[model samples]
Target: MDTIEWQDFERVELRVGTIISAEPNVKARKPAYVLQVDLGEFGVKTSSAQITAHYSAESLVGKQVLCVCNFAAKSIAGVRSEVLVTGVYDDENRVVLASFEHPLPNGSRLA
Candidate 1:
């Protein structure tokens, strides 16, 4: 794997955020959800995620997950994606969220 300098890594804004709402993204070709995340000082931001294989809209609410908060907003499946909810692809190729065992304040930066 290519290695990045600490400064390069630091440029990424990885933060903690909680899912306040989630709903189906009917316009997406593949199954997906539109999520509104509460990022504390950053306020609520929207994201389009293809995590329907393992998560339900109801199950995602109140769940805290790691996020990439500084990425430029992009359009996805007719939705405005403001943040990327971080996760790893499992054995079955489904995304499993990167989450904390203990609750952390929203918008808390990863040191």
Candidate 2:
């Protein structure tokens, strides 16, 4: 694995954001959802997450999750994904999101 200094890692804008809304991305070839996350001062950002195996549109709302906000917006599955919703793959290869059990300020940086 590539090693980096703490400052280098800190440059990545990993923040906490709450899922404001989610919907099925029908245009996607594989199953996916288009999510809108409220990032406090950063405002609402969008992402396309392939987490259908463990999540639903209804369940995602109001959930807080880690996000990488510095990446440029890109088109994914017909949606303009603005931020990366960080997650880890499970044994089944399904994505399980990195989430917080306690509420944090939106856009709170992960130190």
Candidate 3:
């Protein structure tokens, strides 16, 4: 694995956000959801996520997730994805979101 300096890692804008809304991204070739997350001072951001294998739109609401906030925005499945909702690929090749057990203030930086 490539090693990165602490500063390099710190430069990544990883923050916490709460899922305020979620809906199916019907335009996507693969099943996905368009999510609106509340990032406190950073404001609300949207993301197109393929996490339907393990999550439902109803189950996703109020869930706090970690996100890469600094990445450039991209249009995914007809949605303007503004942030990267971080997750890991499970054995089934489904995305399992990176989540926190404890409640955190929105926009809290991941250290």
Give lDDT tens digits, candidate 3, residues 14-38.
9999999999999999999999999
Q: What would the per-residue lDDT of candidate 1 be over residues 1-111, giving only the tens digit for each residue?
A: 999999999999999999999999999999999999999999999999999999999999999999999999999999999999999999999999999999999999999
lDDT of 2 by residue, 1-111 (tens): 999998899889999999999999999999999999999999999999998999989999999999999998999978999999999999999999999989999999998
Q: Is candidate 2 or candidate 3 better by lDDT?
A: 3
lDDT leaderboard ranking: 3, 1, 2
* lDDT of model number 1: 0.97
- Model 2 residue 22 CA deviation (Å) reads 0.6
RMSD (Å) of each candidate, 1 decimal: 0.5, 0.7, 0.5
Model 1 is weakest, by summed lDDT over 10 consecutive residues, at 47-56
Full-model lDDT for every candidate? 0.97, 0.96, 0.97
Q: All candidates' TM-scores?
A: 0.98, 0.97, 0.98
Error of 2 at 61 (Å): 0.4
Candidate 3 is scored at a TM of 0.98
True-structure lDDT of candidate 3: 0.97
